[model samples]
Target: MPAICKLARQRLHWLGLSVCLLTLAPEAAHSQDMREVRRTVRYLTSRHLHGRGYTHHGDQRAAAFLARQFKSLGLVPFKSAAAYTQPFPLTVNTFPGRLAVTVDGHKLQPGQDFILAPESAGGRFTASVVYFDSLALGQEGARQQFLAQPLQAVALVLTQPDYQRIQAQPLLAQKLGEARALVILVPGKLTASLAPRQVAQPKLLVAAPAWPHAARQITLVLDACLQENYRTQNVLGYIPGTARLDSLLVVTAHYDHLGELGRHHFFPGANDNASGTSMLLQLARHLSQPSHRLRYTVVFIGFSGEEAGLLGSRYFTAHPLFPLDKVRFLLNLDLVGTGDTGATVVNGTLHPKEYQLLQQLNTGPASVGPLSARGRAANSDHFPFSEAGVPAFFLYTRGGIAAYHDVDDRAETLPLTRYNELFQLLSQFLTHLAH
Candidate 1:
């Protein structure tokens, strides 16, 4: 009887050990699985992708690659979608002719020394560089001061906070009448980064240069010409659900970047968006099985023309292949590769419950750390969905790499240390949300 009791106790001990090991196994394996996340980031952000813009066929190649990945993962095509590709239209403006700027007899090359506004009317004149301190609309005194000047030569107006608002009211331009030319200098405060060419407004007019100017002698050279037709596209794929076919949880990432401008220049956009696109592919693969019993369908979208005023997303919302009203939530991944410090959850303040749930899930064995929250901002692809009243959130790593919108934002420079934790947290969050 004593021997039998001892044997039973040993069996119980062994059972307890097995359970403990099984519980720890997932975490151990997950830590190692993070290497795959790093690998994905590396591949997507490789130079072979070439900034993923339309002009270089980089965007199309990226779309095809993503589609292949989705197919491999066994994600079924959404209804009426042939092979998981959703085509959209876009009009991109590019510089086709020689764009030059000569200030005080100093010649400047396009993009390096100066960028021609796509809408500027091409002409030439010799005008003094007039400086407008602040062009606020309601400031009647400043408006009068600007209009009263002998607007002959190039008006080199410095940009101010109220410039956009005042410019939105076209009467301000009418009041100033015509000058030799207009040279708007983006203020030192606002000129810290390169503004994306495709997204800027059509404030300037495009024309060939025959040197048309109201004033004479001042060679106000409007050396910019527009290539009216440029192409870009948005990539789409989907994984069908079992029980809830009506509702969808959309995952999106923009795969476009600022293309080359001059020698030794290209915005690689590794952390800016390639990181996010790779995450979308990973999620599609992770949730591919039909037996997973998803409560909502999953859609993966790789948007182009995101650098151009959310153009891809806007087009999708306008001409949706799937019903927009059926979309329950959107998770837009932007920069999730390098969050060693933490990550920011935009729209968290708008959806506190979901944010808190994510926070809680992130506090476990795969802790990523120091998560921050921000109010809803129309800064990324999630903006369109939120505007359409669909619940959405944009996730991005908070720190580590600050080389955004520059050539320095390369894949090899990315710090993907916390990507595994982020992936686990997102996977858990999706699982919980689906339930």
Candidate 2:
């Protein structure tokens, strides 16, 4: 399948006339720089970075690395800042220690067979299992009987669907706090995330197939901590425009992910935003070149705290170093690792002119696939800028590996199918912006 996709991309590459032939800039003639992108992705996914999350100072390490990259690229810091760093505060719940689970005397591996809920609290216990279905919860008597289970002595096991159903009901979800722990059997990939606050109840998410169907007892030991006022930073730099130095064009990608789960396990987050961050670095490198400099200042921002609810971007929007009105356009990239089928542009419908411009540049068979226009969405770093009245678009490539927010989204598996094509498309788009 990988070979087939590579062949298709090669065919697509030959079908389109080079944008350079259309009298674009000299930089448009450069070949796709896949080596740098791959290197960047590999480094970002390395375990040394601790999954770029809140624990182990992962986000801070990433920020420092980006600052060094910006300096090496010859990009300058935002106006008046001592360096290319904008520090901010974040409060997040993190799991940084032992995360063990045992079912019916069978020990399970962390991250592979199970993951703790993002907001789950720490606990060490062996509890008797009480399996329940959604239908059982519907009955008043059964509900009361279940809620009456002795705390610290019982563990409630529910299917993913039943868990979702209970979560939807505030009363039932709160009542669940009475149990010693909650176990959710997920039939699919084990996803991880960040939580703003830690809850009192401990929760375990086990792979459905890994859970013993007739299990009677369970043992779990989770060590979690909630950090307050954790100081992190956003990495920012820019290339000065040749002509309109005051007006700005901005590019952003979050560099944070669901950091380390424990001392030994971490989420690689290759496709999550590492791909986007690497692309942003490439953009910075491209624009910083003398030949590719545009008419307006081009700012590249590697935002942290995105996995913690877009905190970095929200802080920047609230206390913008430069005047917000000076920003002509902003493009936020995430999940750009794969492009087997197509891509989507958030807020495309709200700004038809920009969307149409992308469409014009995306003509020819060389384009990856369909470029779907979507309405306003508060899904990425673009949302705060869009809400502040700056024209912004959140772009993400689709269709490749199913790995996401899980342990499997590693650099080894990222296909980067349409990376070169999308890079070329954006280069042309920037050339048009120069006019």
In terms of TM-score, the best-performing candidate is 2
Q: Over the stretch 1-435, how does candidate 2's per-residue lDDT look in tens digits?
A: 467446534433432222123224444433445655776787778777789988877887678778877876778897755589888899999998888888899998888889989899999899899886566468988777766656556898888888888887787787777788988899888888888898887888899998987999988888999989998888898899999989998999999999987789999999989999988987877777777789999989999999889999999999887888999889899999999988899999999998899998887878968899999988999999999999999999989999989999999999998887787787677767767
Give the worst 10-residue stretch by lDDT in candidate 2. 14-23
Candidate 2 vs. true structure, TM-score: 0.91
Clashing pairs in 1: 119-204, 119-205, 125-218, 125-219, 125-220, 126-218, 126-219, 127-153
Off-target runs (Cα >4 Å) in candidate 2 are 1-32
Q: Which stretches of candidate 1 lie over 4 Å from their true place?
A: 1-50, 96-231, 260-264, 289-296
Given candidate 1, what's the lDDT at residue 255? 80
lDDT of each: 0.64, 0.84
Models, CA RMSD each: 13.6, 7.2
Per-candidate TM-score against the hidden true structure? 0.69, 0.91
Model 1, range 323-358, lDDT digits (tens) per residue? 888987789999887886888999999999999999
